[model samples]
Target: MGAEGGLRERKKLQTRAALADAALRLALEKGPDNVTVEEIAEAADVSVRTFFNYFPHKEHAILGRNPEHLERALDRMRTAPAEESPLTTMWFVVQDVLRDLESDGQLSRRGELIMSSPTLLYQLMMSSFDDERQLTAALAIRMGEPAGSVRTALIVSAAGAACRVAMDLHKNAPDRPVVELVREGFQLLAHGIDPAFDQRGIS
Candidate 1:
């Protein structure tokens, strides 16, 4: 029964990914506003009812209905080595996630589609806020801090900002490695941003 359940879950995930990929491709080929849920369903070879079962709307299809990547990151943190710090575990997970996104190629296309549509970009930002909240909670748990505490909130916010900067840099320098840029971004965070402080030998 457990094996059967696992197979069922995998099938559901595959279907969901197909719908999302179809939605993104159609949105990029046509405009987001021009693409309909029916078109996405047709492209994915799924019924409109099945599409609705996976996503509430077309925007959800493009942005994704769940935070599966964030969940995976949390799982990684949970299983990290005992000696590893929360930040170290975070960097490991971030690097892995960024590498996966870079390899997928769909992420770049999704970014382009979002950038072209103000509405989609706004929706993406709103969805990202929810993701940030989830990450903050997960980081807090990993660090043995109280969830929703100011310290964890600040740490998560800083890390998220650094990653965003790295992604922007990657967009401009597509030839460069995203993981390298992500590492550099975290290094800047660890080293402090102010040149004067570094000169003063502040740790």
Candidate 2:
């Protein structure tokens, strides 16, 4: 039964991957404004309704595309032993994922496109905070803290800002490992450098 369940999950991931790829390809081919869910569905070889099952809307197909990345990251983080702090666990998981991506060369083209596309940049920002909330909430639970507590707030804020900094460095430090940057950013936050992060836009 576990094997069967794993197969089903794998199939779902494959379908989701196909849908996101189709949507991104179409958006690049034409323009983000002109593309529709129906168009992405056709490109993905899935029906429009089936597309909605995987994604709520077209803009989200690209912005919310990296679902697996976060899930896998958090899964590894959540397994840390009692000796490890939540922040430390999160740092390891984030760095591990970034290292894997760097090895696979998955960050260059797609991230470049998203950063350069003004429309997609707005969409990514809008969705990014909301996604951070979910991950932080899960980590908070593991930390035995109430949701949205001051501790959680600090961690989440630091994580969010650190992510923005790391992402902005994508174009400049294309050769550097994202994991190294992320790990260093988290270390800075952990070592009482929160106020030094220059929190202009982060709430």
Q: Candidate 2, residues 75-102: lDDT per residue as tens digits?
A: 7657778798777776776666555445
Clash counts per candidate, in order, are 0, 0
Question: What TM-score number comes out for model 2?
Answer: 0.73
Query: Which residue runs does candidate 2 get wrong by more than 4 Å?
Result: 1-4, 64-79, 95-105, 192-203
What C-alpha RMSD separates each model from the true structure?
A: 3.5, 4.6
Candidate-wise lDDT, in order: 0.76, 0.72
Best candidate, TM-score-wise?
1
Specify the highest-lDDT model's number: 1
> How far is 192's C-alpha from truth in model 1 (Å)?
2.3
lDDT of 1 at 159: 72
Error of 1 at 97 (Å): 3.2
